[model samples]
Target: MLRAEWTKIRTLRSTVITLALVFVIAVGLGVVSLTSVRIAFERGLPLVREDFEPVTDAMVSVLYAQLALAAFGVLVICGEYGGGMIRTSLTAVPSRGRFYAAKIAVCASVALVLSYATVFATFLTAHWTLGKYGPSWSSDGAIRVVLGTPLYLTLLCLFALGVGTLLRHTALALTVVLSFVFVLSPLATVVPGLREVAHYLPDQAGSSIVKVGQQADPVIGPWAGLLVLAAWTAVSLIGGYLVLRGRDA
Candidate 1:
C-alpha cells in the first residue's frame, strides 16, 4: 500500500512543482533576504526590536516554504479525487484505515526528506553569505528553525493531507488549506482582539516555535508551539479518518 501511494505521488506533476517551490523559494529567497539584510547593516540602518531575529531573518525564505509544502500536502490526496482516482484506490486497498495510513506514511516520508533538504539549503546558504555576521548554529533561533522548521513543514503537510482527505476536492482543499497557512491565520493575528486567539491557530502557533526569542506571544514557548501544531494535526487526521470511513470514496 505504501509503495502504491509513493508511486502515485512521485508521478504527479503537482508533486514536482510544489516540492521544487519548497527548495527554490527557500534557498532563493534566503539568499535575497540575507543579502538585503547585510546591505541594510552596511548602510547603517537599524533593525527594530520587534523584528530582531537575526537567524530567522537570514533564513527568511521559510515565509514562503509554508505555503508550498501545504500545497504539496493538499495535492497528495486531493489530486486523486480531482482525477477520479480515489474510488479505484479505495477499491484496491479495500480497507480505508490501511489506505489512509499508507497515504499518510508516504506523504510524511516525502515531506521529511524535502523539508530537511530545503531548510538545510537555506541554513547553509545564509551562513555562507553572511560570514562572520551570521548567527551560530547553536543559537536559539538558529536551532529552532534548523530543527523546528523542517518539523513544522512536515507537520503542515500532514495537517494539509488530513484536511484534503476530509474535504475530498482539490479546489476546496487548496482554498481551505492555503487559507489556513496564509490568509486566515495572519488576518486573525492583525485583528484588534484576536491577537491572543491567533497564538493558538495552527500556523501562528507553529510559527512561534521558529521565531527567535519569540517576544510577541508571551504565552506559548517553542516546544509548546510545536505541541499545538501536533495537536492540530492529530485532530485533523482523526476527523479526516472518521470522514473517510463513514463516506463513499
Candidate 2:
C-alpha cells in the first residue's frame, strides 16, 4: 500500500510541482531576505529592527516559508478529493486507516527532507553573507537556527495535513490554515490579552520553536511552544481519523 501510494505521488504532477515550489520558495526567500539584510547593514542601516533579527534570519525565512509549505501539505490530501481520486484510492486500499497512514508517512518523510534542505541552504547562505557584516556564524543562536528550523517546518506540514484531512475541502482547509498562520496570529499582536494567547496559536507556537532571537514578549519557551503546536496537530489528526472511519467514502 505504501509503495503504491508512493508511486502515485511520484507520478502526479501536483506532487512534483508542490515539492519543487517548496524548495524554491523556501530557499529563495531565505537567500533574498538575508541578502537584503546584508545590503542594508553594509549601507550603515541598522540591522536590528522592530521584529527582524540578524541572528535568526534563516529561522525567520523558514518560518515564513512554512506558510507556503503548509498550503502544499493541505493540497496533498485535498487535491485527491478535489480530483475525485479519493474514491479510487479507497477502492484500491479498502482500509481507510491504512491509506491515511501511508499518506501521513509519505508527507512526513518528504517534509522532513525538504525542510532540512531549506534550512541547510538558508544557514549556509546567511552565515556566509552575514559574516561580511558583523554577526558571525559562530554566534550564539546560529546552531539553534540550523537545527531547529527543519523540525519546526516538518511539524507544520503535519499540522496542515491533519487539518486538510479533517476539512476534506481544499478551499475550506486552505482558508482555515491560512487564517491561523497569517491573519489570526498576527492580528493577535494588537490585543494585549490575545497577544499572550496568540503565542499559543499553532503557527505562533511552531515559529517559537524555530526562533533563535530573544523575543520581547515570549509567552513560552521553545520546547513548550512546540508541544503546543504538536498538541494541535495530534488532536486534528485523531479527529480526522475518526471522521474518515465514520464517513461514507
Candidate 3:
C-alpha cells in the first residue's frame, strides 16, 4: 500500500516541481536574508548582539517555504479527489484506514526528506553568504534547529494532509491552510490578548524548535511547543479519519 502511494506521488509532475521550488526558495531567500543582516551589522545598525539571532535569521525563508510544502500536502489527497481517483483508490484498497495510512506515510516520508534537504541547503547557503556572521554547527542550539526543521515541516505537511482529507477540495483546503498560516495567525499580534492564545498556534508552536534564546514571553518551551503542535496534528488527523470513514469516497 505504501509502495503504491509512493508511486502515485512519484509519478505526479507537481510533486517534483513543488519540491524543487521548496529547495530553491528556501536556499535562495536564506542567502538573501543572511546577507542583508550581515550588511546591516557591518553598517553598525542599532540592533543589539544579544537580541540578534543569526541562526534563525539565516533560515528565515523556512517560513515561506512552508507554504509550498503545505500546498504539496493539500494537493496530495485533494488532487486525487479532484481527478476522481479517490473512488478507484478506495475500490482497490477496500479499507479506507489502510489507504489513508499509506497516503500519510508516503507524504510524510517525502516531506521529511525534502525538508531536511531544504534546511541543509539553506544553512550552507547562509553560511557561505554571511561567512563569520553565520551561526556555526557547533553553536548552541544549532544542531537542534537543523534536526528539528524536518520534524516541524513534516508535522505541518501532515496537518495539511489531514485538512485536505477532511475538506476533499484542493482550492478550499489551500485557502483555509494558507489563511491559517499567513493571515489569521499573524493577526493575533495586533488584536490584543489574542497574542497569548496565538502562541499555541501550530506555526508559532512549531517555530520554537528553530529559535535560539528567549522570545517575547512564549507560553511554552521548545519541546513543549512541539508537543502542542503535535497535538494539533493528531486532532486534525483523527477528525479527517473519522470523516473519511463515515463518508462515501
Between 1 and 2, whose lDDT is larger?
Answer: 1
lDDT of 1 by residue, 86-162 (tens): 99999999999999999999999999998888888888888887766666787666776788878888988899999
Clashes of each: 0, 0, 0
* Per-residue accuracy of model 2 over 1-249 as CA lDDT, tens digit each: 778767766788877787777777766776777788778867878754766655565556667677778887887788888898889989998998888899888888888888888878766766776666434557666666567767778788888888898889988998998898779998997788787789888888867755665652366877787788889888888887888888876
Badly placed stretches (over 4 Å) of model 3 are 45-50, 214-217
Model 1 spans with C-alpha error above 4 angstroms = 46-50, 214-216
**Local distance difference test scores for all models:** 0.83, 0.77, 0.85
What is the overall TM-score of model 1 with all chains considered together? 0.93
User: Candidate 3: how many backbone clashes?
Assistant: 0
Give the per-residue lDDT digits (tens) of candidate 3, residues 1-249. 998998888888987787778888898888777777788778888654566776777667987899999899988899899999899999999998999999998999999999999998888787788888888898778888889878998998899999998999999998988888888889986699898888889988888888886542356777777888899889988988999999988
Question: Runs in model 2 with CA error above 4 Å?
Answer: 46-52, 134-137
lDDT for model 1 comes to: 0.83
Score candidate 3 by TM-score against the native: 0.94
Q: Best candidate, TM-score-wise?
A: 3
Which order, best to worst by TM-score?
Answer: 3, 1, 2
Best to worst by lDDT, what's the order?
A: 3, 1, 2
* TM-score, candidate number 2: 0.92
